[model samples]
Target: MAVALSTVAEAMLMDPALTAQIKPYEPWLLISGVFVLFILRRLTCRALRHRVDRIGYRLFGERGLLIWFWMNAPGVILHELCHACVVLLFRPFGFRITKITLFRIKPLVQERPYGMLQRGMPQALQLGEVQYVRPPGRLVSHIGDGLSAVAPLIGGIGAIIFLYWVATGYNIWEVRLQLIRPGWPWWTLLFAPYLILTITAELWPSSQDWRGARWLLTGLLLLAGIALATLWYTHVLVFNEALLQGVASVALHIDFALLALLILDLAIFIVADLLNRLL
Candidate 1:
């Protein structure tokens, strides 16, 4: 039980994006989730947690396992759907929807004159060829790929903004931050990278050519580099002087960097994959 809790805590800490997201309200959520898990673990004879952990590992892979670092397509699709719905609500006629289909094709051949046949014969009929493609859409067509990337960032940023609004309204910034400080476990910071990655995905340009994909990848890398550099500089010049008051300061900076890189890498990979498939 101790080992399990430690492992879970470590995993959460390592994922800076997740950490950042939960950091603001860590004590309340973490304590509540843990207490709930504890009770449920007892009720189920610890079977449910084991089963979930096993399944999650199978789906998400063990930590630091590159092969397991696959994106959840359903999550991505829903994110895109949310964007589509929003667009339709505001500008219904501006967008069109299309469904993608996959099919198989066979080649056909025709007889030709001897001279023509000698050069090249007409294709003969065949039946086993297959092709997979996305269906056409106007609104989704233009933004499906892009929207998936953007939704998470919007969600994360929006959460932060909402928090700020609430804090200001109730004069809770100091109180809330203080309450959250102790339980701001490392894992919650992962949300930062998650947001960055999603936004980056939204910003990546789409193209059906290898060259274009290369350009997009290059641009993303450059942007990531710039963002990282800016963050580092700010940490040194501003955060160090203004905010780093305790031992947690170094950890905080490191957490921010990790989240940023994670986001950048995810964006680059998704855009590159899409470009490759199209090409």
Candidate 2:
């Protein structure tokens, strides 16, 4: 009943006049949705990590860190594999992945006064790491590094979609928020949340993943500027309606996906908050 109501509401919200008015701004809305979801997801991830750590520690000891790492193993694998796949795509361009570790606790290495190395102090807990060497030259470096770094963002979306389909036998929009159908297998209910929570927990890229992206973004902006200049000079500054609508469609679905994750994280956050305060 609730799902039916939501479906109707979704249709009502898609009034042609309102959509036409907002068509040009859909891209902006997508960007804003992604940014907002990023912030909220990070907070929830941190809280859940903290709660898991505390709970594990309370149950165990230093070994509790293992629980945390394993809990995020699925996410780590997806995130790092995404990076590796993109790096491999540029392999012909001289990119090579040297090492990939899903999770490790590494010591903080320091140079002694005599130039000797002192380590093994349990410095940092790495959820995942993908070490790769990029080709020389600025353009290739920028594009290769940026794409590899942000590959998880794109891959995560694809993965979420696939997992959703596996769980519901329908695309998210088709589900219309009706995740648990009347006559579905039990595995559907079991996988519906498990797979999604595991992956979306680490769907975002860290600050380190964004290193070379600034230069790439700068390059893109410059290219866009040049294209706009050429278009205006030729008096052909026209936006492609089909392309815009296509982008809008994808963005709307992505925003919907992110919104779903956001709500789930909110519920997890509330529960974690309660746990943190209590135990």
Candidate 3:
């Protein structure tokens, strides 16, 4: 199985290689990284979020959700803005984003299962949402909708990278080389982690974003496969490594930034879980 499109879209862009040494394992390595990301997002991220929310709820009830939503304001705005921005770019192609909501004040009421019985829960609130209108069943709409659905992912990752640069003097290679910059200000790094938390938590596309995206993406994958096969057969296909490797490098960096967030989230989760149990 492939990585979820929204999570690691660039992994799918791996170009076919001509070299026996790097070609075979490059895609596999990228795929594995994506698989790990999916696992982390599904299990680790989910657990961390839920654990914190549990603590908040235990303390403040539904009001806790409101507070949590407000705390994640940066990410919420970025997420919705990503959708609206990308969708608006498709305006030339006949798509119009009808609404751009940064955040909402109301709680999301839904049913939950408890002992084979369902009960309504009002502990969840929507932080932000973007709504677009497009002609149904058109190829253009499908492509537009699919791209827009995953825009938050690209935006979130970009935000993380930017925050890291702002805090670390953008010394990416220094970090890689295990060299610490002397006399770095401690306060410069203060808000990056919290901002990253907000971004990652809100990055995943909501189920509503996938309403018209799955079919479009499936079709795209099929088309890409056919294109690769056809071009490979012609013997004139250019085996590009530089571009592919560059993209992979950037993606790896993005993943590492996210890994840092996961680490911090784990620490927070431990504290939240412990506090919840005691209180």
Candidate 4:
């Protein structure tokens, strides 16, 4: 009965037009987001100092920093990207991979039927696979997460450099225009804070200092919700129809995707916590 309900719910959530609205520029946003994430990490380590060390130790033991860089960071990026890429590759018909934000405010992949109950069942079932990748074997399974996280960092830098090279050949005005042109949308700048907060929140070790980190994560989540609401109310209401239209178009699926990713992230954190306890 549960399986049947889950399958039926999944079928209802599939929408090709909605999916198409979500794709197109995800890779670029992902790459940019990664670069921003690495920068924030460096800043956080330098500024937070002892607090970070404590969090790291709590999450990953003696080699906390190494574990964070190699394990958690990568794991998160991959986890998010897996949703985006998988939808792109497999459910191309019903899925749209529209926009990928450097900020992890929302799910990497937004689908149709964004309602909680409507979205939750399908995601819970799909993410069941991640559970199997556990323990000793998990170290390897964790690799996907790590690589996914790191890929954007590497790709983003490469892209910026490539853009710089191309810009060099043009006139000064042209170069200026190019830098602030068709490629880099003005909206990206506006979204920077959310991206920074999201990445930092995600990659920061959340186990040993579970209480503190969890509190922080909870706060960030609240802030994200507020920001999304504000954006929807102001921009969608006053200035442009595009903002509301874009959001409305993807609203249903986004809810489902966010719920799924949150569950997966929680699972990873739980697994890491349990492993730490066992060891």
TM-score of each: 0.25, 0.70, 0.70, 0.23
Candidate 4 ranges with C-alpha deviation above 4 Å: 1-61, 72-246
202-226 per-residue lDDT for model 3 (tens digits): 7776665554457767888999999
Mind sharing the TM-score for model 3?
0.70
lDDT digits (tens) for residues 1-279 of candidate 1: 999999999998899999889776554443354345434334442232234334444556653122111232222333334434433433333333232111222243343211110111012322111111223454343343333223334553444344433323322122233423453454544453444333332222212212213433465689998987898877753544234334344444333333433445545455544544454
**Ten contiguous residues with the weakest lDDT in model 2:** 112-121
**lDDT score for candidate 1 against the true structure:** 0.37
Q: Give the TM-score of candidate 4.
A: 0.23
Which candidate, 2 or 4, has the higher lDDT? 2
User: 121-196 in candidate 2: lDDT tens per residue?
Assistant: 1225455667777656657767887777678778987888888777766786552666555575768756566668
**How does model 1 score by TM-score?**
0.25
After superposition, candidate 2 runs with Cα above 4 Å error: 1-38, 108-123, 173-175, 181-184, 225-252
Comparison by TM-score, 1 against 4, better one: 1
TM-score of structure candidate 2: 0.70
Evaluate model 4: give its lDDT. Answer: 0.39
Cα error of candidate 2 at position 70, Å:
1.8
Pairs that collide, model 3: none
